[model samples]
Target: IGLGVIKNVTLKSGEVNGLKISEGKLAGFIRIRDSGKAELTAIGKFVNSKFFHHLRNSLILATLTVFLTLLFVVPAAYAFSRLKFFGREHILYFYLMFTQVAGGLGIAGLIALYGMLVKLGLYNKLPALAIIYAAGSVPFNTWLLKSYIDSISPDFDEAALVDGASYLQIIRYVLLPMALPGIATVAVMSFIGGWTEFILASLLLTEENQPLSVWIYTLMGGIGRGIDWNYFAAAALLFALPVFIMFMLAQNYIRSGLTVGGLKE
Candidate 1:
């Protein structure tokens, strides 16, 4: 019987008789059906079966993205903070302005640009997201790091220079250790931003590679007949826990980094 083939199935008022079952018979019929189908239906309603895989994939990709952002951001932050160069201020300002104007949605144009690059064989890839995330973080991280760098006494760099240390040596040996607290601050911020970033990742990544934020949004009454709330909450809580832990651990460094440059005489 159709009823035996389907388990835990809910029929509307009209469809009950088409399967030759009255409303009263439907419940008993569903209860006697295969246990596997019943379990599947329950799981589907409870856990958003459509997006469960996407959610898992997003968490993995977001973690990688956070790591990648940190790897690039630290060195770039160091350069912007300590190195004197032509057009430095202009570059900083330009990035600042761009960040201000362009939000998650603003990157749609960039996504199109990426598509064009992809047609030239460069689309829907991890490297593309990495490049965008790194570039996007540069201005803010540069300013943040510059402030921290300014807080460090130039005497340290001067002392290192007197010892015939090259610029690379100075950064590695002298500045980097002193800048650890600030670096920690940048690392936390950049990682969280990338983890929560939805639009660009959603736009740039294919369905198989979509981030958690995008995956969550997929459950909201669009892809299926109804929205699944219980699953959405579970997934959201899982996505948020890491960010919460990261913030709590880095709170002290963030406070110190922010306050270090203030109160100059």
Candidate 2:
């Protein structure tokens, strides 16, 4: 509705009633600014609130998710890529099937997971959240890394073995170096996944233990409190800050990781 009346308005010599329409995209700016004002005006209300604490919780989960994903995915990927073992093909098929299992682990499964966590005394905790994130991410990360690792020549592994270097040493110095971009991709994906995740965070966490996603959810829900939009926008923008930095730092590796995988049999 806001844009409907503006499109056909003929500006008189780039002036609309003495307002310069010729200036930088003022129409779009006005639209955004108008909408943004409501959300941006309450910034002060969010500064010292649970927003920061939730952000810290999110950071802990994202960092731990990355760490755990790397530990589990990297070694699993290397083994799948370089090692020939009994039922290797069957194992790959089973893994691919298991990846499909994640999709079915939806709302019902989330509740069941929460129940199990509560039973184990792990619910409402950052470590519990990180474990969930890592479990969800490991399959795809391992598959992607395996595809990239396979693209690397087996001769590197053979050469390391001939030099009396153990498989672990070869993986550390050779395959790991070759798969650095993929590793960054995995880390970024895990970080972002844990960072933006909402449902589980909201369900499994409480109060200050909640992450930014849930924090923002509650902020948006205070309809009776005339919820401040400025604070909400500020919180959102703050929530996005770390991921933006991650992308800027690993921009090149992100593209390479996605494309380099699946290039070889």
What C-alpha lDDT values do all the predictions have? 0.64, 0.74
Q: What does candidate 2's lDDT look like per residue over 233-259, in tens digits?
A: 777888889999888767876565445
Error of 1 at 201 (Å): 2.3
lDDT per residue for candidate 1 within 49-132, as digits (tens), equals 345576565556555655666666666666776678999888878877876776654555775776676786656775567566
TM-score of 2: 0.77
Residue 74, candidate 1: C-alpha displacement in angstroms: 3.6
Error of 2 at 101 (Å): 3.5
Cα TM-score per model: 0.69, 0.77
Q: Against the hidden true structure, what lDDT does model 2 obtain?
A: 0.74
Error of 2 at 143 (Å): 0.8
* Model 2 ranges off by over 4 Å: 1-43, 252-265
* Highest-scoring model, lDDT: 2
